[model samples]
Target: MYGCEWDDETGATNGFFQDGYDGEDFLSLDLKEMRWISPVQQGFLTVQKWNKDTANTEYQKQYLSTVCIEWLQKYLQYGKSSLQKTVPPHVSLLQKSSSSPVTCHATGFYPNEVKISWMRNDEDHDEDVDLGELLPNEDGTFQKMSTIRVTPDELKKNQFSCVVEHQGKTIKKTLTDDSLPIGIIVGALAAVVLLVVISVVVFKVYQKKKGFKPVSASDDGSNSSAHSDAKA
Candidate 1:
């Protein structure tokens, strides 16, 4: 009979080979029945190991790919909705062209993390730009706003630009100047001012008319006669 154990704890597999060994550490060919079962069991074990290894490899690949996609999305700021880890920052320029110095305000920026600045040509804007509040995103990033005072000349040559920097990436957007038809706006305002002035004058004239009273000479005859007597 052959002695064999199928588990390490019980010394099953090795036990069979150990007890079945001949005078040397080798087994004799006459121990066919005992050795035969080993080949079958080894085949089964090999198949099981191959399946487990394949499954583990596939899982690792999938996990690594997912991690890579997430890492890229944090900086890319654009792409698949599922991979949209960061919201792209937006900016708008607000201008009051009629004011002495045209006012430019910029709003909307994201990861909520960034710095905003204004430039004239390419110089640092000192008093020209007023930085506003830095808002936060739900994801813990930051958003900041800023405004700049631009002169007519700057607006004309398109010398002003708004710059945003985040995570070492810089984005610059050229400022746009929307022409306000001064003639039309001023004409309309003038028409209104004229209307107001005319209304005021008319009101005054109406009050004068309401307060005026005609005096009759016949009612003042006694006073006039006394004045004539004194003169005489």
Candidate 2:
């Protein structure tokens, strides 16, 4: 496999095999550090040989360094304008239980620099906010989260929200009060719906069983004739 450089100042990694570009299946290497970081570990014979050869070619460092720098420059210059975009966050509020902190998650954003806040009654409440770090998504986007603690009494007031600032847009998501009761209500409603459906099905089956069944045409005529004879 192939890898790329990690820029410490910018806190990003680049050039990860380009997703269908040139890459070997089992020969991983760090081209910038000149190290076999994977597949050719320390105890391998191939590692020993490669290390020896690399040490012998110390004079080639200048050329390799130049190539790495130029490659980075070319990619940074050509790709940034077209490939980079700022994606807005999708905000949500979650809680493990009634007593847990309200975790406000802001996921699916790009550029990795976003500000998340937990507010009370439209005012910033920093004392209760626990800001989390930016995390990378599988699609090369970023996600972040923040949380705030709340008591049951405080939750009853229902004046809490999570706000996100990204790409010059502000998005706020409000947290609901008494989530446990709401969940119970929803579950009870579902159960009631299920019961009603079951009752309707059972009633239909019972009615089908109790429904009148007409006799054959000849039998009905014979019964009517017998009744007429008895009445006469």
Best by TM-score: 2
Worst 10-residue lDDT window for candidate 2 reads: 16-25
Highest lDDT among the candidates is held by which one? 2
Candidate 1 overall Cα lDDT vs. reference?
0.54
lDDT of 2 by residue, 133-172 (tens): 8899998888888878898788778588888999889998
lDDT of 2 at 155: 72
Candidate 1 lDDT over 1-232, as tens digits, reads 3222233255322222221324333221112322222223334554355345655545434443454345444444554553334545665555544344433333343445677777777876666667778766555555666767666666778577787776567778776556563445667799999999999799789878899543444548886676666669
TM-score of each: 0.35, 0.47
lDDT of 1 at 211: 100
Local error of candidate 2 at residue 177 (angstroms): 1.4
**Any runs in candidate 2 off by more than 4 Å, and if so which?**
1-73, 178-232
